[model samples]
Target: MREHYRDFLIRNWEKGDRTRAAAVISYVLSEYGLGWEPNDADRDVLQVEEFYLATGGEFWVIEHQSQIVGTGAYYPINRGEKAVEIRKMYLLPSVRGIGLGKYLLQQLEAAIANRGFQQIWIETASILVEAVKLYESHGYQPETGVETARCDRVYVKYLD
Candidate 1:
């Protein structure tokens, strides 16, 4: 079936969204030839509402026809830090190139800025060229360090 941008609704992650969120994330990761490790921080997203809310951050999902097609979140990198890390930002292929990723990034940036964050950080794999390009195109600058086993590219965006 065909879907339009307006058919998707972005909303806060509720208890019921855990399963679908995980599924969507897993699917996207797998599509990139990446396996979802049980210990990954994203696996804990199912229970991270308190962490996000307590840290003046939030997690959101894009739903279409009651199914989650995309997901993203941001949380303080550490206590008292003015920086937050963007996490779990992924969208199904069916919804890519239609402005959904940009929409989510814009929304996340606004939320983080409104919450007093001064910068946003993101870690991504070089294999995902499109994602890296998207971040760079949106003003995120490449940075050294902050590499993970799976994510080697680190980017930072300072908000004015």
Candidate 2:
């Protein structure tokens, strides 16, 4: 971790970022005792092109000191009309609580709105208390029908 959390850079994924980005996601999930399996819970991570970039969506990589430390992304989903689902929003333990998560989330929201998506949906596990609070604090209202195997909660927010 660097002293300047704000010094990191967020950019569209490159073909070479696949492994490092997936590792970042896996490390963060493991910190909470969660499991990640390629082509399953992490299928989109494995196929970033097919699941995201090729489908009118995006996946971003956050890097600090030349190392990838976090990831955030979204993709259009069938959950709601003109809606997109936020996925793979993970920050390493060392980078938590420095406002980076909030910044990254805002970036995601802006992209969604810029694309004319009417709303944003998020599915997460209750054990990830920080993420739960982040979404709730940002006005993502609680909802039903969490489709992820490890998630027990859902939140959705309509764009203005």
Candidate 3:
């Protein structure tokens, strides 16, 4: 499938978007056996909301004809870090393999770069081969750091 690119407005997520965001998070979490069983908790949803309100992070929804097909976010790291973590990337199953994920990542990286961030980092499960490939293809490489036993891999890219 071919994906047509368009500028998705990045904005502060509203409470009403919580349900849709939860669905996206749930689908992703379950797809990778993240131990987040359905109806178990709204932890992902609450985290997203907190990320927005606490760190002033930004989220972008990949809207096709006014429907949210995917979502992603960028959040700050620390004082004078000039870096951010790409988090909660998820796309509908129908949109997978359509180049939409790549386009969304590109836009997200560009958006962060435009904000003057110099580095970007992302963590993915070992089971998520597709996501790992996407990050590697986009120049993200495995990094040595505080290893997350729960996460199989961690990647970083310097946007110099």
Candidate 4:
């Protein structure tokens, strides 16, 4: 289904979306001083098919004026009971504070729950202040032992 956000369209991943989505993710990471790297946790960005969709998870891309501006995605993880990890939830600075992040997150949670996932987890770096705040405000209580190399914080929320 197609979802809209103030002229932006939210849609599922397509083969053609790989490059645009990766650029969005890389841009956002570099903008935050995180500089996208081809590491363990981030390998998913380069392998969206195998990492998310092919694994039974979902990925979304948001475009405005025909330009990709943001991305959000998740994949099943082995952390908790039937758990999934939120990943690549990034938006251009121009789109921040406009509720897109919250909207994407709510959509992800709903989709995950509908798929029978029991919990959601996220790994993020403290440098991403907006992301950290968004997760906390959405009932994702902070957790310890973050395993993502570029991340120092972990948060988890139960769907049940």
Candidate 5:
């Protein structure tokens, strides 16, 4: 990759990064036709930050070309079950086919593995065909079969 194309970096999200994070969420909401309002995206950004800061979850932002284009976080879902949930994986609309999503997924997998999380779970809308495909492409399989939180399909991945 050229120097400019090599500008992508994933780092811990800071409080000051809310605006950038919101931008990525908005892109996701829009691309998936989620109809999320600006306030909703902003609120989610705060929630993500709080999740990471409070429970020691990992929140990451992908900065490409000096802009936040992708994001994902992992948080404990069931300590007794030795599992963690991967949440809010998003890539901007414009950067969809450029391999950024794969990079983000790889980073999340590495982070979760390093943290000793035995299982990784993800819940995404059933209508989100692309997201579902992404998860399935990454070795995630359907673990749960009910619609929840406004009709979403939940999936799980086990790490070796």
Candidate 6:
């Protein structure tokens, strides 16, 4: 991979990041010929902190040249549950093949493990071949019985 984004910064999601996050999400889905669904609307991007941080979870954004290029988050599946659900991980085409996705996944995994979670679940579309490969490469295994109607693939990783 070439060194294209030397100034890339990965940080926790904060106030006022919703607009950029939403744009990145929209762009990625549209690029893949997908549209916003009910699940997307339910997320309420503007209240990320409330939906993630306030619920013993976290959301992060990757910024390059002061623009948000990627977004990822994990939220508790349920109160008192030892597992969390990974959601909304998206990256722009310009930064896709440079290890940023792996970096983001690693960071999110570390954060989730640090919080004492044992299992991490992720739901994604079957058409997102790169993402599936990324997760499998990092030790995420495919699992059955996913709950989301919007996504067709489910994966789980158990932290050591």
CA RMSD, predictions in order: 3.6, 2.9, 4.3, 1.2, 3.6, 3.7
1-160: candidate 6 lDDT, tens digit per residue: 1123367888877788878888898888888887865355436566786788788888888889989999888888852259899888999999988888988888788888888998999888888889999988999898887676667988888877
Model 6 whole-model lDDT (C-alpha atoms): 0.81
lDDT of 1 by residue, 1-160 (tens): 1223577988888888888888898888899998876576465576666667666678888888888999889888852248998988999999999888987888889888888898899989988888998999999998888646788889999889
Give every collision pair in model 6: none
What is candidate 2's lDDT per residue for 19-135, written digit by digit as tens? 999999999889899998795879999899999999999999899988999999999999878999999999998888899999999889988999999989999999999999999
Q: What is the lDDT of candidate 2?
A: 0.91
Scored by lDDT, model 3 comes in at: 0.71
Candidates' C-alpha lDDT? 0.83, 0.91, 0.71, 0.88, 0.73, 0.81
Question: Best to worst by lDDT, what's the order?
Answer: 2, 4, 1, 6, 5, 3
Clashes of each: 0, 0, 0, 0, 0, 0
Q: Which residue pairs show backbone clashes in model 5?
A: none
Best by lDDT: 2
Please estimate how well model 1 matches the true structure, expressed as its whole-model Cα lDDT: 0.83
Candidate 4 regions exceeding 4 Å error are none
Residue 3 of candidate 2: its Cα lDDT? 24
Q: Residues 9-82, candidate 5: write the lDDT tens digits.
A: 77888787787787777767776677655454235467765666578688887777677877888888763267
- Model 5's alpha-carbon lDDT is 0.73
Residue 129's C-alpha lDDT in candidate 4? 94
